[model samples]
Target: MTIKEFKLPDVGEGVAEGELVSWLVAPGDRVEEDQPVAEVETDKALVEVPSSYDGVVEELFAEEGQMVPVGDVIISFRVDEEGDGGGGATATDAEPADAQPDSPASDGSEPEPDAGEAGDDGADAEPDTPSGRTFAPPSARRLARELGVDVAAVDGSGPGGRVTEADVRAHAEGDAGSADADAADAPEPRPAPTPTDTGSDGRKSAVSKRDAGGSAASSATAAGGPEPAGRETTLATPATRKVARDRGVDLDDVPTDETRDGEAFVTADHVRAYADAVESAAEPTPEPGPTDDAPEPAPAGGAPETATASEATTASGDETVPYRGVRRTIGKQMERSKFTAPHVTHHDTAEVDSLVDAREDLKPTAEAEGVKLTYMPFVMKAIVAGLKRHPYLNSELREDDEEIVLKGDYNLGIAVATDAGLMVPVVESVDEKGLFELAEEVNDLAARARERKLKPAEMKGGTFTITNFGAIGGEYATPIINYPETAILGLGAIEERPVVRDGEVVPAPTLPLSLSIDHRVVDGAIAAEFANTVMEHLENPLLLLNE
Candidate 1:
């Protein structure tokens, strides 16, 4: 059999490496060519890595959390013959497929972490460690360290004598203050701590067992160790732990949302909801005693009290959204841009009464050309005119070569906001495209970008970026430069505002604009000149026609 090693391709231009998010097909799994073998997250987007050869998967070279560089061998495929490899594995210039099947791939849907993933993500289930400790998940080990509890002293509550998250919490709390301590002190009746029944506080867990879908058992009963049958353990995820910690809520006290394998599971939502309820209940509400004619309804157990937001809607509240794929990528890119570029923002207002009227005049002409003309087309034209004069703003400083590279071609990056994150789809050779062409392309690109159908190539080779923040109702921001590019322009809402015309105040359509430039490549004078020239073109649509 011929073993073929498939290297991770450079999914996008200039992307050095990508994080191995998950393996879609594990070793020994049969797969066809182009069937995605793994999911990788680049700095720009989360993409699937398809198998280039049709064969059985031999080895997976990269772990889920490891960052593999471009051209690095990620997987090996074993084929029966030397030349009979290729079948259907080809990546074309089309919209990328969704990454992790469970994960919606940056579509703003945050799914719960799978129990299997949790093992690798937090559980350090290695048989032995350098610290001479038994197997436990990383989270449980961390909690043990935090509470000054020795893992060696605590009993394992997980399957196969594995240490669990709750085992450590209960150990640290002293397991009902320890039986010896109870004997030494006052003889107060206290329940002995059991892996299956007691909570972190060392009490018979008060969390309802009915919520735990399984018969009064535990979440990890499938692993099967020595856990009791009727007792249920309180289970909280890492995110829930953080929320409980921040709010000073006991993990044991937070009511269970559900039970996984008889273990009462409390999620981050459960903690937040419980905290909100507690806080709301603490507030003093003045209530007039039951009126003579009408009396307030009472529950079978007690009197009716004020309704808390949590009680009314248990699901509505703060959520712990994990920054994993594209959303995390955007954050890192923004941080790099903000920190690397010495930013200088200049805000200005342009009276665009004539430009608005010009768009209205050419609406029919644009429609006849199969394009719906918008102010963005006029803005693009005006930007190109300004860039032609102030070429420095449309250039980059090659720090590696220690020289300035002025781009002759105007490739504009139009920042489109989507539910996932802020994405910029590039429009190449803007100077060559007419108003109708620009309008159609912009419309197409924006629509596709929102739907996440734009290819990686469509987002590349940008000379300058323009973001229409006004569309989302905002004005004047220190827009971060799209890295490697020298400047970014921000457009605010174009609304009717009072402006001075011929020494007299009059209501006119005004557009607010903000420009952010990289001080290392662009001087204040050049930035000011570019801003003013762009505004001039915007104010007088005829100026763009002349250009």
Candidate 2:
């Protein structure tokens, strides 16, 4: 049999190590090429490692929860003599210099058997001796000994009648322990209960002895029976329950009304009603003091003593939610970006009245071409035009070498907000695509991103980013720079406002722009100049078409 070793692949984003979360295939199982063999959790994300060759799993090298360095063998496989080109070979047959006995083969197979197992001769060996036991894998035997059990006494339960640790533990508790313990301390076996036949009985059922009572005791307790009292009960939803936990309110302590049907449940409305009643009942009133006992006078030019309330008020209308998945990922990324990037934001408002006219003029032609026109296309086109003039903004800084690497092509990243999180998909070579084409590409990318269908490569390698928060009604925001990029631009709500045109007040379309740039690569002057150039294109939209 040929054995092949499978080393851990370097999951991109420069990960050095990954934790083995789970193994989908165990030793002695058959696996196919390109089949996922194990799931690994890296610092960036969780990825599954697929088998490179088709073979029988001979051994698993890494245990679940173990952290494996990149390039380390994680599994091994044994293949047929024809070899299947999957690199299946036994460790004993052609052992690698760094091959550990438990290391995974590149072909996802098991290692060669140990010398003792290979040399053992078939015979009717002693039941108490370890050699007499059916072959147990190293891990199984180790676990058996750790649990203080004899493998030979255990029944074989695994494949090929292998004695597993579970079998050893079961036998030890069931039979072996009983024989080893002192006779007086042994557990007493219980006697089976006697059964009575209940056939064709037309008489009343008999009651248990514990339930029988005399009339005198019933009469006495009847006079002292517990009394029922009226009390208010509250209801709450799952979301409210979570909020109560965060606010230190005990749900059990909160009175709840019993339901007549199905399960007893609480509603959010009931909880709110109880909270309101408590607040109304606890309202405070002002008190008047004696006229002679006047309050102390304030000193000249001194501030008055403020009455600080010690207790905090409970939240009334707000709901609490746990951070998870993509939202959690976004939170971590924002935290890192905000702290790592020394952000310096510069804001400016630009008049886009002419740009609006220009878009209106192109709307008919764009419709004829079966494409929807939007302000984003104009913004992106302007940004790309400006980036070409100010190339520093379209670049990343390498901190390790303290050098700035300017990019030749413009991979514009359009920031899209989805239910999952904020995703940025690159629009490659924006300088080459016209306004209508760029708009279509942006629309396609945004739709795919929201659907979570954007490939890893599509979301990577962005040289600059634009976040149009105006779509959601934000006036202006200092957007965080999508790092390694040096800069990110924020487009605010475009509204028609009165402007001075030829010394006369006239309504004009205005757009608010906020530029956040990395000070490490571009200075304030350069960033401002780039923003100004972008504004110039937006003001004179004809320039975009000419370029």
Candidate 3:
């Protein structure tokens, strides 16, 4: 058998690295080329990483929750010339060396997920993972943390005992408080898995370069006595502490499962494992009854009645969110855009009564064809026309070569704000598509973007960007240009306001527009002209037919 290493490919443009969210395939699993083996979270979205080779999993190079740099070997596969790599629904689901998949039934296979047929997967399914590690999606784990439920403690009813989002929600709603509380109050140092010799992410492992700890017996104290008073409570690395804090766990309450230098030692892995146990074992919390005479319960850390939340935050009582994924990526991009491009915003409003009437007239016709008509299609069509007229608005400046690049393709990126962050799913060749086609594509892409299903290529190769801030209720504000793109058009709320159309102050629907441009590429006059052209197309939808 020849071992071949599979490195993490760049999932998104300029994405330096990604967090290994979860391993869809375990060691010893048979996998095919292009089969999804891992879920990697890049700055843009949660992407399913496909394997580049057909082989049996040899060794997993990185663990979940680790931020691996791009081009780092994530997993190794053993490709035997004579070996059958045809992936079948394995009886074992390719369990790792020491870990076993959870069994919903006495039989060691996963429960059937037939939605129509109810099986023993709901209440009876419990996490029977004997190994310390648990296998669940990163999103499921995050939901568990927010619900204060432990994912490892929940019985997974999913395929191969995989915990699903529904499992976490069910765990949070039902059986939320259980024996897990005692374990959470008494977390311990976790035995570290064997460290990989791959590139480092600059995080510390709880297990130092020495003997570590692990065992079922280590989780609890001896039944005969209380924990030894003289024994140390917790000793951990800084990275472990930071990881624990990020997981909303307190290290002081965590039990020291392993002793180092006559003291209990803990690692970042331990804190995470303990958190899993805590949330999984959690049962439904009972609602509190009111005490009329009693004062309201104080939140975490003591705060004065007069102090504002900002004051309390300054008083060392705030949760620190590690900026590494999409948020971090957005920060870097925004910084580069702000500093590199001298941004000048032009705000304007157009009384779009005719446009509104045209959309209203087309609504029924579109609905009859089973399509929903939104203002976005009109806005996109207008923008494409404007781009053609003022090419500078849809271009990029190459400083290194001191040249401007005007793209022939009209790949319009629509900025969709999701829970993950701002994701721009591009609509390629917008000029070639009609209003209905554009509307369908825009809706589909936006839907998929929020669900984190948009492929890496769907977000790339954009000439200009559009951000519809009006959907969230704002009118006329400066918008940042997506880097490498010369301009971004922000649409504000469309509402009826008194307008002087033909010198008459009658009620008319007005649409607010904010055009932000890279001053280096487009001056104020060019931006204003582009905005006017867009408004003209919008006001007279018949004019769009001329394009």
Candidate 4:
């Protein structure tokens, strides 16, 4: 049998190492080529690693909590001889190969300790240590060392020789404490005692003297054992642990009430509760009203009419959800875009009465062609035509080395509001597609995006963005600038409004357009020109078809 080693592959841009989040297959389990074997988390995203060879598993070289560098061996598999030994394998009755001297057994056996006492005598360690002693997961060892507990004393409950943080904490609080108490009570050789201070009455106080003598000894004992009492205990899930780490919360000190299998498993709710408690404890209360200058009591049947904003925000029955996935991504990106780009908004109302009539005129043709014509299609077409006429606006801005870069390609972004969040999917080569084709493509992209089936590439490389908040009811808004691009156009709701035609006021369908442009890239004059171009297109809808 031949062994094939599967190395970790680079999953994202410039990533060197990834944490093994989970493994789908195990040693002795048959797997096929291109089958998912493990899920790895890079700095950017979580990606699954497919097996490179079809074979019976020979060994798993990387542990779940371990960070495996790109191109490093992660797993190996044994394949049959006639399988061409490339990336294919077949079952065999042969015995597994001998494990490496320092490797843990593939049968999910705990690694034995490198023969030595709990402390001291490092040279007396053994060569083949069990997974339990030497292979404690990253979080487990970190918790153990931080809490002054020995990892070797903890029993791991994770599958396939894995140790979790809970195991370490449980061992510290339960077994380790009892074991240390028993060891202290044992009849060991006593050390010489130091002298103590006497009280003012010339008599040694029983408790004070005992404490004085034990202080130094206690320090030494603590160095060799668990931490001193009264430190807070924290229990949380792996995901919650990650959140705590990101928020700079000391997981060892987070107070929790829930326990899983005798170990604390803190949920997101527990962390928030702990945070609230801490905030409340730290905040100072206002001083009580003065008695001499006693304020008058409230009138009978009278109370405060309104609650404070904080109280109102917190008192509602609505649930608070921590943002994840696309929403979280949108929040971060929008924040970055807003902070980086100096946005300037220009708002104006366009008389869309003619445009409405023009859309009605083309409705029959659009319906016959299996397309639903909307004002957006004409607006998009007009924008494309204007971009062709004024090429500078259809570009991206790059301020690197004190020089500005304006890209030429027109990759327009259409912001589609989904149930999850607002997603802006790019429509490439917008100047090329006709109105019907643009409508079809836009519909397909928006539908696919809401379904979460849009590729990452589809969400990027936008030169300009349009958000039709008008469809939902908005007049004009200072829309946030989509970063790397100079501008975003907000389309407000079309409503009947007074318009001046031939020096006479009359009711007409008017559309409010709010254009936000990056001041760093485009000046106010340029922004006005772009907005005017869009307004011209909407004011004369037939211009799009004529162009």
Q: Which predicted model would earn the best TM-score?
A: 3
lDDT of 1 by residue, 60-133 (tens): 55555567889887776544452332211211001011110111111112122245533433321112223223
Off by over 4 Å in 4: 1-320, 323-325
Lowest summed lDDT across 10 adjacent residues in model 2 is found at 191-200
Cα lDDT, all candidates? 0.64, 0.60, 0.68, 0.59
Error of 1 at 412 (Å): 0.9
Overall local distance difference test of candidate 3? 0.68
Q: Indicate the worst ten consecutive residues by lDDT in candidate 3.
A: 98-107
Sort all candidates by lDDT, best to worst: 3, 1, 2, 4
Query: What tens-digit string does per-residue lDDT give for candidate 2 at 1-547?
Result: 5666788887533346777766655443445677677766543344567888866555455655567888987776655454333222232333221221122222313333334533343111112323222356545544543443444456677886776777866865676545533212322111010001111122111110111232222332354422211222222232444344333333333345543112233334444444333333333333566743665544222223321121111234445565543445455667767888789899998999888898899999999998888988888888988888899898888888888999998888888877545667789888888989987888898888786556546766778999999998987898998876789999998999788989999988899999999887889999899999999999998888855
Cα displacement (angstroms), candidate 3, residue 356, comes to 1.0
Give the CA lDDT, 0 to 100, for residue 267 in model 2: 37
TM-score of predicted model 4? 0.51
Please provide, for model 4 over 40-108, each residue's C-alpha lDDT reduced to its tens digit, 9 standing for 90 to 100.
754334456788775555555554565678988777666544424322112122221221112122222
Best by lDDT: 3
> For each candidate, what TM-score against the reference?
0.55, 0.49, 0.64, 0.51
Q: Report the lDDT of model 2 for residue 176.
A: 50
